[model samples]
Target: MKLVLSPEQRHLREAVRAFLASASPLPKVRDGYDPQVYARLNGELGLSGLIIPEEHSGAGAGMSDLAVALEETGAALLPGPFLATTFAAIALTRVPDKELLTGIAEGRIAATLDGTEVSYDGSAVRGTLAQVLSGMETDVLVAPALTGDGPVMVAVELAGPGVTRTVLETLDITRGQARVVLDGAPARVLGPRPEGGILDRLCVAVAAEQLGVMRASLEAIVGYAKIRVAFGRYIGSYQGVKHKLADMHCKLEQAESIVRYAAWAADESPAELPEAAALAQAYVGRACFEVARDHLLLHGGIGYTWEHDAHLFYKRAKADEVLLGPPRNHRARLAQLLEL
Candidate 1:
């Protein structure tokens, strides 16, 4: 599998990065999402359609391509339904729905996966999800519900009756989250319960986003260090500061490699994806949080203030660390996978 990004991938990354730099600047992100900007991202840039099949009016791209877009978005902290929609799209791939897929690709629908336990009673779905990503903004929810026979995946329209979504306050205010309550909500069964396939893909996708966070945090500190003066010398010149920066850089490098490998495995090496995903989540997850923490610390008192962007990175790091499961949980999974 190709670990290195191809020219096309590089071009896509650059385009995404440049577009985010202009369209989703930090100030814009802090103000919250703009529907127009998101529409441009999906319709003009085609990020939402990156991984959907060409038959569904999507690019029919692979995980690597999606990874590139996610990394750029993570760096920009572009708040909206992009990540949530991507998760829903990925889940939908396992249980194909031409209409949903096309709507997602065309930026006509926003979706997310509900990580709560809901019960499916033959014809209806009932449950209360404490938290759901983009829950307030999404049009559709792909949730796993328990049925009489077993667990099954279902798609429920949020606009329908018997669905209540309450916005929740979270550390990462950049992303919208809500408490979703379903009372016998109408739902369409997708397929049998997803085992490791969906989880692995989610792990890899989040890992890639974490990789971008790590790199951006490192770059921010490094750039700050070059100009910040302390005791008649640049702060970056101090041995202690230099060493810490070097360590962050090392972790960033390792994270990028792991994320790339996981993305590659998802696209071209299906058999190796689970292990690669576990490794990516286990290592990159914790590393990104650490790097984000150091990024705030290295920036001095200013970093702790509400006006600074360092806290944003740190918050995102912490949120992502627990988004799927904590790094410790993934480490345990990795050990089990190896039968160690």
Candidate 2:
């Protein structure tokens, strides 16, 4: 498949890149930027409602467009809860809560999907959902859990009584994650437990973001290699470094192919979506992390220091790889899906 983006999609990516250039440059993230800033921007850009139907106060662009927008955001390392908020928006689309969707589109409310947890009693959830992108400041939490009816997602207000949020000091300072405690908190079940494979859709969306991260990391490293010198010549001139860069480029292209395939499959609901999502996540996760680390090494000691932004992406890549589900989990799923 060519995996060519539509003209509108291309425009969307360019527009988002332009917006981030002016509003959400890397410095903003380095300064411990507030997520509400992007939340408000999302409202203004109508991104919060991109996947929602026009009748529901959304652009109704669908997953592919949203994935393209997120790819640009990841490239810029735009601070805030873009992914988490987007996931929340997806969940809201299934519910009859017009108020919730409108609130999200207008930036009046923040929401996140806690797909990591499987169950929760009133007081606490027994499992750990790590690296919850955009979990820190979201007002609503949508989580899938096992109920008598099967697996279902329930929406809970974070500020409601008996809810506690503890912020985790994470390596990716630009984004935030928090462990939420729900003590008999009131929750509204969004819909019947998803048995027809809704979680697979969510996974593909995450893999799309990983693809963006990998591309950005690859670009950064390649750019740095051309400028940084060793042995009185640019490091990139060395054969050893050239091979590494070649490998990184190849991996990134492979990841791009899989990600685009997964995104397309998600939109069309193809039989290949499950396997594509797994392949994309498994490969992109590891490739992006390795590329980021290699980029750091190319920067020599400077990349290792906090002053340099390389480590920021390095950490984000690692965290994102393991966030929704690690490569190992995805690979296992692929094996099962392929009956291998």
Candidate 3:
């Protein structure tokens, strides 16, 4: 199987990178979510529908294409519901909800899904989800809820009655998180339960995002090292600093390799996807966080300051490390999957 991104994928990367450079600069990330910017990203670029089927008014692309775009978004730290929307879209595809998928593709609907302990009794769900990605303003929430028969996937409308949402202050302010409490909220049963592949795909997507953060962190520190001098010599010229930067570069390389493999597996080899996704999260999650931490430290005191972008990268790295249940969790899952 081809491990490298195709030419079209490369062009997609360039286009996404260019758009983010102009539209999602570092300064804009601090401004929080902007509907207009997201509209352009979704409407003009068609990124929101990149992985959706054409019949659903989407781009009908695959996971690899989505990975390329996600890498660029992560690098730019583009603030919006893209990640949440992507997760929602992927989950819905299993049951193929025409209206939901079409609305998501059109940028009129936003969604998120993380399995919860809510109780589902026939037509509705009731319980509290402590934290949900983009739940504060999301239009729909797709999650697995417990029932007498078994766990089932349910979709709830946040705008409808019997739902309360409270935004939580997250370390990475660029990505919003919320607490959702549902009191017999009306919901539609999407399927019996979320598919195993769905989780694998989500893991792959997150690994790709972490890959971007790693690359950007390494680049930022390398650029800073080239010019910053101390003791009458470029800081990068110092053997100690060189070692750290070299380690970070190596980590980034390993992460990129794993992420690419996982993304390919998701699209081309369903049988291999579970193992590949586990490995990607197990390795990339920790590596990205470490690289970000080192990147911050190598920048000296300025890196920790609020004024510098270094802190933002560091925070995102940390947030993403735990976004999908930490590296250790994935490692355990990987070990189980491999029977090792």
Best-first order by TM-score: 1, 3, 2
lDDT of 1 by residue, 190-303 (tens): 888767588898898898888889888999999999999989999999999999999999998888888889999998899999899999999998999999999999999999
Candidate 1 RMSD to the correct structure: 1.1
Cα lDDT over the full model 3 = 0.89
Instruction: Provide the clash count, candidate 2.
Output: 3
User: Tens digit of lDDT per residue, candidate 3, span 251-334?
Assistant: 988888898889999889999999999999899999988999999999998898898999888999899889889788999999
Cα lDDT of all candidates, in order?
A: 0.91, 0.76, 0.89
How far in Å is the alpha carbon of 161 misplaced in model 2? 1.0
List candidate 1 segments past 4 Å from native. Answer: none
| Predicted model with the maximum lDDT | 1
Model 2 C-alpha lDDT per residue in residues 1-340, reported as the tens digit of each score: 4388989999988888887878777777787656656665675577777887777677878778888887877777776767787887776666546777777777777788876655655333334455455666778887776665466667778788767678888888778888877666777766665544455666767767767777887788788888888889998899998998898889888877777888888778668778877887778788878878887887788888888888888888888788767789988988999999
Backbone clashes in model 3, listed as residue pairs: none
Say which prediction, candidate 1 or candidate 2, comes out ahead on TM-score.
1
For each candidate, how many residue pairs have backbone atoms clashing (under 3 Å)? Answer: 0, 3, 0
Off by over 4 Å in 2: 94-96, 116-132, 145-151
TM-score of each: 0.98, 0.91, 0.97
Q: Report lDDT (Cα) of residue 317, candidate 1.
A: 94
